[model samples]
Target: MTNPVKGPTGRVPGWVKVVGSVVLLLAVLFAGLRLSVLPGLKDLFGTETRDRSGPALLESIQDISRYEAASGNFQVVVDLEKDAKFLPDAVRGSRTLYVGAGTVDAYVDLGALDGDDVRVDDDRTSATLRLPHARLGTPALDPERSYAVSKQRGLLDRLGDLFSDNPHSEQAVQKLAVRHIGDAAKESGLTGRAESNTTEMLENLLRSLGFKEVRVTYGD
Candidate 1:
């Protein structure tokens, strides 16, 4: 006869066998659930699948039309210190000083190119492309780089700040920063550089497509 299984108390281990079986069953269930949900887990994690290559794979020319050629970045700093007096000659006033930094992007817009704007030689050896003027996009204020340096309020002005929910002085400073940065970008010749860069880009692209010569020009 086979020897009987002896537990710690010298009897058959009925409870231990049941606990082991339960643990094994739970593990198998967990593995099965994991395998079933594996496919959709990527979506839950915000991972996307797509083709990032150029639009040359499109079937027709209409699908691959507009291109934004960003060519220049302008960095600007603006400083302002102003005192606003409520009364004509009163000494009480609010004084604020702020410094802001931002970047402006210059790019060439090519969305309106028509057949008349592009001409390719019959032999595909040369091409001419007329593009629109280079324009400055909106200035982006870098919040992390911009701040109010100092703020001073007179006796009367300090009382107003205690109950005011809006930060009027800070807002004014930000507006001034944007206006000055825009003006600086225009005076810096960044737009001209953008135009040159965009021309060079198109020339290189055309050359890749077997073009021996490429002429790019800007139109009003």
Candidate 2:
């Protein structure tokens, strides 16, 4: 009988092993690049190195009502103009007209209240409460409605603006317009009106709570 022929054992070739190593190295490098660029990828893949939500988680459950009070909204329109001159009037640089529409808030804070500020008359028939005075908050300019009504820039003005740190001079003018709106709202008795409205509101609320008489006053 002829000797049985031996078949070659099945095994991966050396070239195949080298190719597999290169592919694995490339895959590891690509993964490292992605992880470096996208820090959130680690969290998405459940490989976050550390927890960073401690403070945010704690703040999420805290109450925010301890700092607020009654607020009233007032709409105001402010017209303002500013002129910057590099030379004589003949060489006027820029004259800008800004029209700003702002919403001003007037608030009455109750955070300063104490037990003595609220007094109940004998027999509990009436209650008198003294509250802090109403004050005006900053005016929030409406980006949609507030804009540069007109801007006239002379040759020098345009030339200087090209190199100035603040290229847009209208922005500063718009800020001034907003400030004027807040000032105008305050001067228009807006805060006093807010105080009156707040007092009336609180009086009605207290009356609804079975108080025969409710007197609400504001302190200086």
Candidate 3:
């Protein structure tokens, strides 16, 4: 039998060359498919999101008898940090910086007025009224205006977040912000301004009602 032709030393066999060429062609085709078609497939299969929420229900209606006389806007920066007892920050601690914005309203309750609260002169030219002092309402935080500035978490904290439903909750910081805003409103003379505004409003209304002199007073 004749011997098969042999290539030079270190040279690859003809069948090996054929197999390599086929592999190269297949690799090029696969790369082209990845560049052109894979993205569309991904979008069609696993990339879309759907909202599955239920419709909102109207709970209750309330009648507001308080007149808003003043509003104060406030902003606060909250820096909160938590660390483990014996571990370093890099291993078990978290720090968050947040900006909170809210508003506090001061008002006078008109529904609390009784018949004895108002007295008119015999000639109907003068009036006297006694009302309760203005009070501050609950602070309302503006979600659109509030945001987290920065967050740093240790390895353990990050790993814990993967299993938690609310990975990064702002409830604590939000409560702190509300407290600060409420305190600031108390120090801002908002209630005093509300009282003054209510007095002015009542005086104007009484004068328009034919009373020449109006005396408005606030009690505890």
TM-score of each: 0.63, 0.59, 0.77
The TM-score-based order of candidates, best leading, equals 3, 1, 2
Off by over 4 Å in 1: 1-91, 167-169
Worst 10 residues of 1 by lDDT: 63-72
Kindly list the per-residue Cα lDDT of model 3 for residues 1-220, writing each as its tens digit: 4335445565668898898899999998897677666666645445567999999999999999998999999999989899899999999999989999999999999888888998998999999999899999999999999999999999999999999999988898899999999999999999999999999999999899999999999996
Q: How does residue 183 of candidate 2 score in lDDT?
A: 71
**Best-performing candidate as measured by lDDT:** 3
| Deviation in Å, model 1, residue 48 alpha carbon | 34
lDDT of every predicted structure (CA atoms)? 0.74, 0.71, 0.91
In model 3, the clashing pairs are: none
Q: List the residue pairs that clash in candidate 2.
A: none
What is candidate 3's CA lDDT for residue 127?
A: 93
Candidate 2 residues 152-195, lDDT tens each? 76677678778999877567776777777767776778778778
lDDT of 1: 0.74
Ranking by lDDT: 3, 1, 2
lDDT computed for candidate 2:
0.71
Candidate 1 per-residue lDDT over residues 1-220, each given as its tens digit: 4446665567768886898899999999997678667997645655578988876675655542334455334444444444554562134665566777888778776768889999998999989988888888788778887877677666666677778887454777788888888888888887788888888888888889899999998878
